[model samples]
Target: MSVVEVREDGPVSIISINRPDRRNAINQQVALDLQSAFAAFDASGQRVAVLTGAGEDAFSAGADFTDLPELWRCIPTVGITTDKPIIAAVTGWCIGGALVAVMACDLCVASESAKFSYPEARLGFTGGMIAGLAARIPHKVAMEVMLLGATLDARRAYEVGLVNRVVANGRQVEEAVAMARELAESAPLVLGTIKRFVTESIMPKGPSELMGRATRELGAVRESEDGREGMRAAREKRKPVYKGR
Candidate 1:
């Protein structure tokens, strides 16, 4: 089975982390799968996406302990560059790297049973992608969650601007999908412009986020058709015209 699952709902695509056995914990393979799933969504006809985990027990227990991923590679805005909006439907525990991913999304919908935490400071290790949370939400609240490892329940998360809406546990995905459907009906160009403006011009990026964006852009160039053409031309000792795709 795929570590991540994708299913389309007209203009909205639901991308799920299919690891209920691991509580949707993100390992290296999960991270890579997520990157591929979202990249495909961005390039497809889907105008919006709702990202969620398989079960209601936990959106994610955070990064897999035994096999920690380069978690940044799955985070929105960082690893993937798309102007299309992503709405996170969170239920249960959204901790560590999970919190980082949700905060980067354009909007978040959390279930009443949901809980958000960032315990990296206490764990004596961090990827530092969560630092951008301070710029997204209130600094004190971000500091409390990151530094003191304070847990924010759904209600508190909504109040602190960590989540856009709070709903019943099982309704998180439904509500998020409804929201995405609404967005899908809007002018795609306008939505894309505003999203790009806010994320690129308004939001501040942390070091890890900056690095992730850099690598994603470079990888795109390396994987482009023009890149392959150039390589093939060099091998044949002939000049090649580039399509600039």
Candidate 2:
């Protein structure tokens, strides 16, 4: 079965991460499928895209630990500035690299049960969350999130401008689709132009540069002593004894 599912809803395209059994954690295959889904949405006539996870448990739990090193390398974490608008329909635990995916979207509509976090510090990896989330939330909030591995519930996330909407539990996808449909009513060219202008104004580096930076930073993390320890601990179902190396 496909790890990611892409469906058309009139002018809106819905792309869902379909690994509910794994709390939607992204592995290499899932990463490739997700990229393909977004590529199709961008190339198609779909005016808006809504990204979600299959189950109510999680939008994504982060990268699967079985092959932690390959997760970041294969996952599409940086330089995705799509001309067409994309919305995130988040619920449950959206943690670690999952924060990057959510923040990358133009808009996020989360359910009451949704919780956002960056726990990569514990995993011996620096989540590229700062660059992705800082522009969307306050500097202090962003710092705390990455440094302290802080978690924010749906209401708190909305209050801090991390997400656009907080709907009742189980309504995340519905609300996001509704919002996308509303956006679809506007002229496509105008919407694309506005998105491009806003993106250009905010992004500090070009997509290519950002991608290169992400790869280098993550590569360093993968080679760290703590990185191997973290992965081993995860596979062993125990706490990592981080030596801060």
lDDT of 1 by residue, 116-219 (tens): 99998888998889999899889999999989999999999999898999998799999999999999989999999999999989998888888888887888
Clashes of each: 0, 0
**Winner by lDDT:** 1
Model 1 residue 87 CA deviation (Å) reads: 0.5
lDDT of 2 at 125: 66
- Per-candidate local distance difference test: 0.92, 0.80
**Per-residue accuracy of model 2 over 1-245 as CA lDDT, tens digit each:** 98989888889999998999999988878876776677677788889999899989999988888745233332333434368888999999998878877876789999999999897777786645446577678988988888888899999999999899999999999899999999999999998888887766655553444665567577668979999999999999999999887
Q: Where is model 2 poorest over a 10-residue stretch in terms of lDDT? A: 69-78
What is every candidate's alpha-carbon RMSD to the true fold?
Answer: 1.9, 12.0
The CA lDDT at 29 in model 1 is 94
- Report how far off residue 216 is in candidate 2 (Å): 13
Q: Give candidate 1 misplaced runs (Cα > 4 Å).
A: 225-245
